[model samples]
Target: MYLKHFGLSELPFRITPDTSFVFANRQHQEALNTLLMALQEGEGFIKITGEVGSGKTLLCRRLLQSLGNEWSTAYLPNPSLDPDTLFLAIAEELGVKDAVGLDHFHLVRRINRALLDVARAKKRVVVCIDEVQAMPLPTLEALRLLSNLETEKRKLVQIVLFGQPELDERLRRPEIRQLLQRITFHCRLQGVEKLEIGNYVEHRLRVGGYRGDALFTPGALRALFRASSGMPRLINILAHKAMLSAFGEGVGRIDVKHIRLASKDTEGAKSLRWFWF
Candidate 1:
């Protein structure tokens, strides 16, 4: 709605994970480096945990995009399935043929065969499972078992888990200690820093096709950082709504009042009544 008004070709703050809009802040870059290093080292399992809006999914997508042609990737965005179904999903993603009707044993054999084929081709396989905290204990064990599929020198398949903070708590359970032990590398993602908010906003705006002067005033930026607590998702939400508010008022620039209105209208955004210049 505010595209033409803000001189933007597209909405800058859509919550969906678009790699083009990635800010590459300190936390995200460090996490990405850790993941790449772990994958290169042939680590068995790697875990990334963050608060709900801390850009885990975006980083996951960015990792997938950064991978070279030598990698065979399987992305499981939904992990709510049972153990059998989980294996089937991985098998299907790996291009295992005739996997739909196979029993659990047969399916595992087929998946192992496919992974071996990939290994023989001198390529690596990576399985990224998002929202993994919701996965059942048995299913997680099944995942550990899948990780057991390896060659003499290195793992045949590397598993990367992207999930909320609850995933850490779930991993502490005795039922899945074996799986926890397998996580050779882990990283905790945090919110955007206060200093980075300005550049972050500007970066997203530039990617969204804004070629005009700064659209958010200094006071608006302060109010946004306070309201969003530096979480990228909340920043996007408040910033988008603030732009819409400015647009509705026939204004080209956003101010503190716009952010106040956006915060009030947004869930999980902090109140800014005590935030003064």
Candidate 2:
């Protein structure tokens, strides 16, 4: 609503994972580089864990978008499926018929055949599961089995799991410890650090075409770092509200007062008040 008022081409603080607005702050860069390097090494299974709203989904999407033409990706946003259902989801993604009705045996053959077809056509498939913490134990086992698809030289189906810390905890289970051991690469994503908060805000603003001078003052940005605790989602939430607060008063820059007001009105801001991002 305030895009024009702020002379922005798009909403700078949107909650969605728009890769164009991805800020390559230290931790984000490290996480991406870690995953990219691991994938290039033909790792069979990789898991990336982060706190909720810490940009795992965004990173996953960015990875999918940036992958080379030799790569094809199947994304599973909801993984709370039974083993048979999980295969069905993969089959459906690969455009197989009777995905749900087939017995587990048929489902596996179908999925494996489809994957082989893709490989023969020269496209390696990567199955990326988001919120993998919700995946049933058998489903995870099924996923591990899927990773077993490989050519003589390299893996056919590489899996990338992006999820909250709970997913790591889930992988540590006794029954799933074997699956955890199958993970060839793992990376943990940390939130934006306080030093990067202001730059991050500015980067997003510029990406959204905010041509004005600094929209947030030094102190206000510091306060925001605290109130958001370096979490990108919360930072965007606070920054968006701070801008609105400033706009309401017909101002161009956000000060601490504006941040404080924005914090008071924002959910989860209270918990972060004790620590700066």
Candidate 3:
């Protein structure tokens, strides 16, 4: 709605994990480097956790994009599948045409055969599971078994888990301790700092093709940092709304009043207390 007013080719602050709007902040860049390096080293299990909107999916997409043709990838955006269904899903992803209606044993056989075929081709396969905290315990165990597939040198299926903190809690259960121990590398995504917040807003605007004078004043930006707790998704939401609020008042630039209104009007903004600075 503010596209024309902002001179933007597209909506810059959408909630979807759009790689086009990915900002290369220091933490995010470091996480990506670590992820790429871990994958290259054939680490069997890598876990990346983040608060609900700390750009986990965005980074996951970036990882997929950075991998080359030698890498075959299967993505499970929803991790609610049971063990049988999960195995079948991976089998289907690896092009197991006869995997339909297969039981767990049959599915595992099919998937292993596929992985062996790829191993023969000297290509690595990565399985990325998002929202893994929602996965059933049995399903996670099945994933652990899947990760056990390997060549003489390295794993055949590299598993990257993108999930919220609940996944960690679940992994700590006694039954799943072995699975947790298998995780070689892990990191939690956090909100940017206040200074980085300023760079962040500008980064998204520029990425969205905005070419204009300064849009947000210093006071407005500072207010945004406080209200959003420096979370990128919350910052994006508040920023977009502030721009619209400014447009509504026909203000040439966003001000404290506009940001205040945005913070008040956004659904969850009023609930944040002094827990975050």
Candidate 4:
């Protein structure tokens, strides 16, 4: 609603993970580098964990976009499924023909064959499973088994799991210790640091096609950092609302009062009163 008022071509702070607007803050850049390095090195399994709204989904999407034609990627946004269903999902993602009504054994075979075909074409397969903490133990085991497909030289498929911190707790269980051991590389994502918040906001605004003066005042940026605690998603939510608040008052730049109003209306945003004194 405030795009024209703010001189922005599009919404700068939509909650959805848009790769185009991704800010390469230190934490996220390091995580992306770790993922790329691990995959290039032929690691069989990799794990990434972060808190709620920590941009795991965005990172996963960014990784998928970064891979070149040499890589075949299968993305499972929701992996909370039974073992049979999980296998079928993987098969479908890998473009296995007639994968719809197959029995468990046949489904596994088809997925294996698809992985082999990709390997024969001199390309690697990477399966990215988001929200992996919600995956059933049996389904995770099935995932591990799927990773067992390999040639004499290297594995045919590599799996990358993106999830919340609970994923670590789930991997700690005795039944899944084997999978834990197979995670050759792991990275934890942190919120944007306090110092980087300004650059982050500016970067998103530039990506969203803003070409005017700084839309958020310094005080507003400080208020936003404290209110969001540097979490990207929370920052986006509070920033968007703060912009709307400023626009409603016929203002061009956001100030502390705007951020205060935003925090009041947002559910998880931290209260500004505690930081005011």
For residue 196, give model 3's deviation from the true position in Å.
1.2
Task: Give candidate 4's total backbone clashes.
Answer: 0
TM of each candidate vs. truth:
0.98, 0.94, 0.95, 0.97
Per-residue lDDT of candidate 3, residues 6-125 (tens digit): 888887778788888888888788889999999999999999998877888888999999999999999889899988888878887888899988777877878989999998898999
Please tell me which model should have the higher lDDT, number 1 or number 4: 1
Off by over 4 Å in 2: 98-100, 271-277
TM-score of 3: 0.95
| lDDT, ranked from best to worst | 1, 4, 3, 2
For candidate 3, the lDDT comes to: 0.86
- Give lDDT: candidate 1, residue 112: 93
Which scores higher on TM-score, 1 or 2? 1
lDDT of each: 0.93, 0.86, 0.86, 0.92
Decide which is better by TM-score, 2 or 4.
4
Q: Candidate 2: deviation at residue 169, Å? A: 1.3
Total clashing pairs for each candidate: 0, 2, 0, 0
Candidate 2 weakest ten by summed lDDT: 268-277
Q: Which segments of candidate 4 are over 4 A away from where they belong?
A: none
